[model samples]
Target chain A: MKTEDLKNTQDYKYGFTTNIENIRAPKGLNEETIKFISNIKKEPEWMLDWRLKAFKRLQVLKEPNWQKPKYPNINYQDLYYYSAPKSTSEKPKSLEEIDPKILETYKKLGIPLVEQKRLNGIAVDAVFDSVSVATTFKDELTKQGIIFCSISEAIQKHPELVKKYLGSVIPLSDHYFATLNSAVFTDGSFVYIPPNTKCPMELSTYFRINASETGQFERTLIIADKGSYVSYLEGCTAPMRDENQLHAANVELIALDDAEIKYSTVQNWYPGDEKGVGGIYNFVTKRGACRGKNSKISWTQVETGSAITWKYPSCILQGDNSVGEFYSIAITNNFQKADTGTKMIHLGKNTKSKIISKGISAGNADNMYRGLVDIKNKAINSRNYTQCDSLLMGNKCGAHTIPYIKNNNSTSIIEHEATTTKINEEQLYYCNQRGLDQEEAVSLIVNGFCKEVLQQLPMEFAVEAQKLVAISLEGSVG
Target chain B: MLNIKNLETIIDNKHILKGLNLNIKPGEVHAIMGPNGSGKSTLANVLSGKNGYITKGDIQFNGERLNDISTEERAQKGIFLAFQYPLEIPGVNTNIFLKTSLNAVRKAKGEKELDTLTFLKLIKEKASELGIDEKFLSRQFNVGFSGGEKKKNEILQMKLLEPTLSILDETDSGLDIDALKIVADGVNSYKNKDNAFLIITHYQRLLDYIKPDFIHVLSNGKIVKTGDANLGLQLEKTGYTSLS
Candidate 1:
């Protein structure tokens, strides 16, 4: 590679916003614009009416100012509410038939349409740019009565399921981002495993935001019925663009009696340039509800990208004898900022939750771990344990932890522990002395720090997340 | 193979090595005996390019100046310094670390890397030579290892890397006589006409197994006296107050 190419490689990776025809409003957000989006997607009359109600609620809502390092007010009118591959009139049935430009973008991000053949048991839905390209292993999943498809396709094929559980966990006006997602959300994944049938393979969705000046509001809903089990993985990467983009995703999951769901995310969005110019403002709301006795739901996320991230994937323990868990590793480097954690709300008897979070800050980045655990008066014998550890790679970075606990139940046990530490130079020297380069040493140390979180991922995605950690830390090390 | 000239070092604004000068030729063994806080361990660290302050010094190895290189560079150039306190690196297997280090040295020397089978054989042979159990290779590096086991593992690395200049910093500090003999025997087997040894210790017990031609007494960061193996015995009996 040429010297010039090396500099631009990092540049183009984050700045290459794809050229695609989009159905967008003239400029900003208004009731008319919301109605325009609903009309373009050809939504039913009730959905359009729902979008209007959300838009009205958004007018009264105010942007939260409690977060550290305030961002310039986002011009709602400047964002394109909708974008899709203009060349594709119909979704491709096979990986080969997908648009070449769209496929090439995912390839550059190291997530191709084809599974890394070694991981044969995992099914992948490759969503390029704005739409899902091809859903793999559908025939096999169908054999077990599992419905895994794009959310849009699910709305067309299984509307009853979508309508029944779409906004159950996160109400339309739950948060600012969730409100926006409920308004103009385009495409995400839908997974429904039938009662008593275990998912035959890990289901995954790879998301890419390829258009400039666009906001990606994808809605994902996963349902595991009685006595069923499923593990799902989600990954994302966006090409570099000078124009800051917005991603407001809403993910809701429902677990019925004796059912279990594991959701893992490796989020590597475009985190702007080293100087922290134009990148993704990733604000997402994900929540799961254990609605039946002995149900379980867990969320594990590794966030290594995004210029500014505001996310809290939470769990509502509303089922007796249910279990909830959240494992997360968030990394912020080079002017990036992350304020992420999870919330566990216990409203049922004998409910339990575990939260383990690891954050790494390098360069001049700032990261914070903010979490909440609440036990209601009816939640008898509710229990929770939370551990948050932050690793600061350099003295220039900052790490913070904020945990909130509220309990009205007399028999609840809640504990919280947090620690902030810097990577000791002596440790680096020791690792270097063992023949690992500075980058490798950092990767090794960081990986060890995050092993707990990564292990929660599906085996195949766990390996992929490990490699992403190494690549993401490149150039940040000595 | 190793030369130190008026080596003056300081750490945290306090001097550690003051006007210390020593030399070791190929095929020779040099033992440094001193009281606590003497410059013996500092000498080993300085030779291995460890970071502290060198207020005044000149170090040459194999006729090449050594102060400007990185610790890893010095290591790749056949200078091995067994740390007094080997760090515990969890999640990194001992075998992986050893192979990576060996390959780094080999690559720097323009030699072919050893394959897995050959590497395992060498490791087994070296482990047996040092009386280290085979199970140690699969365990995390230095994690949960006893003090003697850590020292032996350091020796195991030295045996694998086969550095031309080996500095054992207090390798005999926390070892029993049996472990000390095993460690000393490991060092003795690695000694050759093409390599040199710089053994730094507070006591003279290790010299009984691995004899040194020249013994030096360091006090207050400077070499105050130089003698033969008898000097170590004298220091042990008389202590540094008389020598200083």
Candidate 2:
């Protein structure tokens, strides 16, 4: 590596790549590309028809440019729609059958595909490039009537569930990136918790983007049946590359009567070098629908990566007395731009929602929190509370908050609170005078600022996220 | 020991400390008295390695050049400065801040850091000795603390860090008489043959509780007069106008 390139990989320790030969679809976005992707997965005719519909709609749909962060145009035709590890063509029944190099890559990324060696005992479905390479804890979960596997497998194994709730929450024609994802998304995790049962362990999926010039388009669908509960975790990272990569994923969740789904994501894709020469453009659309009375959904995310991240994991409260929550901590450093928040659409009576967003911007980065809460006239006596806080490290960075509220019901209550603070020299000096270095002081103060949202994560992930929060802002100070 | 020679400080092109010199050995508490705009706080800030100041000359602590050493390095080497206006760092719990600070200093000193239980016990005893409520230890660092409470917290930190050289910049400004006495007692009890103090104040009020070995009256960015502890009483009677 050149001396200049060494600095790019230092702070982002997940910058190495495995030399696995790839079986890739031809470059470009056309009917043939979509058919090729669908054909490779051996998806049923209905699934291919759904992709064709999305691909047809994508032609008339224009990309939304109303975001706070602007970027140059993306050449859709020059990008590879799908690239999977060649060995994954023949499905691996066990870890022994899986390619050794892919296993080593996961091991290097701190995700052991071996079920017995899972550090947190989480049942993880490891997705590499554009394929689901391995999934753990299958038999244990199967005994409990829980189905956790790759979406491709689900399409072939449980097509009825997939067809029933695949695009129910985030429709195929939602927006540009979402439609694009719906058309080309190759693989992601599929989880289904049977009625009246609680998942025994945390279900997790770790996404990795390795092949250069390949856009990772993953489609995830999770369904929690009546009287059931499940907590799902998603984590992603990519190898350091000089060319910008795109990751546009669509995640849909459905909660039935008395069921609840808690989804948490820790996204650490490789943000570009300090000069913003290259990184991942993470544009994802995730939404959950409360389809029956008393259903609940919570979204918690700690986003500290990507060159330009534009996502809003939202919830549609269509069930009476259903609850929705969003807790987010988005940290942007060194030319990274993140515009993320959530939306709560209340349609049922007495529904409730809460949002807590914390954004930290440093080293010429821009962070924005844009959220919306809409309480329809039918949603009588609904309540919503929102809090957004921004912490700035340098004068060059920017923090913005734009909250949109539409409450048509007189009896509904909505409250919004926001605060923006700069990392003042006095606070830094005080900490330093008490024996902390510049980076440690910044990290301590930032961790405190993010404590409210960080607490929403699981215990082990909270610690790891705290350390990642610190590592993300490594060069932000003097 | 702390040493200074011809220290000149210019902040934003305005000379604040013009050719100021001071020296103190262990077991000595020196008080600097001056009216407003006399660069009393500027001296303390420059000593603490605050940014945005242009300084010339030398500051030495135990035969080491502090000219280029960072603020945390100065602190790790046993030089502590209690700010005149201790910052209200929101969201940071007081107990956690104290533990992290204590551990950092301990680690830098080549010592093993204390466990949570031991550190908590030590901090609890220190807080009670100063009459601080135990509940205040868990609240956000100085977020809703009263002026006097903030001063006491500063004193509590002084006791915790136990630096070789401590500079209290206007520590008595917002303190009530009772709080002032407690703060004075904190300094008095921490006083030993191995540690020293430099107290900067606007009035001789704090000196009544913690008597100083030397009193320096500063005017127009310079220390115009230096005398024994009697100088404080004399200044209380005559005022700084006489020295000018």
Candidate 3:
């Protein structure tokens, strides 16, 4: 085989850039850039003030270096904070009016944004570059009193809901990356399910980063009101480039009295080439709060891409009899590094939490699971169960798990289980002897290792996540 | 159905099967009885195309050169090896693994693969022959299974694949007498004029249930004696020491 052809085989299968003109903000993170972002969105004055506050707080916060994966310092002044497709400058009224190139991108990614070819039983809000181009099934969702639209539109049409929930979970002065997202964040999906309602279809958002030298800082806010239930899914992919792009998204979820929120993410951004030349630096802050009694929130993620990942989708069980659960499968291969897990905080009486994390590292990659389970003094009879399993492929890779458990209440209980294992050659041989090829054997075994976490995803996402689990481990086996 | 000539197998630079020779035809059941460290399992592994073995000499299966075929391809072309200890794969449902393995072999042979419903029906019948519980078929593949249950699973796989040549590597080592009968019954029901068996064991008891046409006494790294089924009974009276 030619060297070029062999190298292309290892490249991300979804590596294609869409050529489109983008109206970009000036390359900087100064107050002017923040004001420019706010004006471009035609935001209200209060929102602009909110952005300035976050930008002011961001100046004093130091970028955290405690993560295991380290990269060169980001030139905040050299990066474009906002890049939106020119056609989306005046928000398109419908799918017919949206730019065809943006629709084509989503179609190539197997998510048809067209009216007739839409995915069945699901509503999708396609976010291309730094703008939410089109959101489907809005009318149908509106009939059921569910608000599903882009955060930019939510700010315009449903400001009260946005104002009531935005930063209510992850506050403006939360941390470095999160505060940066709050200052100049672009478009992302926003969901609000009213009380005593069950969402009829799965609500989803597809994120694509196509602009060069632009950081995608999208913000997602979901609120499930009293006695309401909603399952929201987010998927992301990026075009392969030679320069590392930053994706710092802030996703905040809130569940009210007797409400349940299921949030799932299948993150398959462009991981760098074999030598780790360039890829997405995914530093995201995702947190959910069960704020009302008898509320529940579940987070399921299948993270398979990004050159370096620093993310933890955590949950706060703050209401009486509330529940929180996190199921994740993070696979890093070919010079990728991930320091990701979740935290469960029990602060209410009789609260409960469960965490199941599976990390698979291969091809000189490092995968770590750092988690915390804290039971406060007020949380009498609280219960927490955590299981962390790591699977390593080849001696060149590494897997690490760090679990912190604290129980201040004597009546509360926290149980932890951890196991570190290598992909057994004998198991692969046995499967091969049963007629499975080496690649197929590895895929099957790895899928088995991630079964528990995969089961937590929606049926539509579970099948795709299972295949991603296999594809992520390709070339790691003989 | 199978042929091996001067098959010298070395694992980790340790020559185990030094110049071993074997031949078997259709509808024939061959048993190899030996003491400990007689290279019994090595021969089975070599025939199954397992790794870590540096092999020299020719092995032909169904008239094709076996040395070049991969382990999965060998099974696709009708060579089956029942392992002594079935490796446990957690979280892989037994039924799903069986269906995948069966379909892989079937697809390689250019046969249409069976769908899930048909596969379930077919496997249910086969599992019933060996008395495997319906719940065990849904459990994780071989994980937390008893020694006898693991052996039964191997036989179930052997029956599902229906290979022309089947090699049993100490399958009766941990099976009780009742489980032995079930395994023997499974083998007996699957026996046909187009298929053959190569049973490797340390005892002659399994041979009594599923009698072999030829009994080969293996010692050190090669077969030292070859006779009919009656030889197993004679060797039982006096251990492998007499043959060596």
The segments of candidate 3 whose C-alpha lies over 4 angstroms from its true place after superposition are: A1-9, A117-119
Candidate 2 chain B: worst-modelled 10 consecutive residues by lDDT:
B83-92
RMSD of each: 2.9, 2.4, 1.6
Query: How high is the CA lDDT of each candidate model?
Result: 0.83, 0.93, 0.93
TM-score of 2: 0.96
What's the TM for model 3? 0.98
Off by over 4 Å in 2: A1-10
What is the DockQ of the complex in model 2? 0.75
Query: What is candidate 3's CA lDDT for residue A3?
Result: 54
TM-score (all chains, Cα) for each model: 0.92, 0.96, 0.98
Candidate 3 chain A lDDT trough over 10 residues, lowest sum: A1-10
Error of 2 at A61 (Å): 2.2
In angstroms, the error of model 3 at A383 is 1.0
Relative to the unseen true structure, what is the C-alpha lDDT of residue A319 in candidate 1, on a scale of 0 to 100? 92
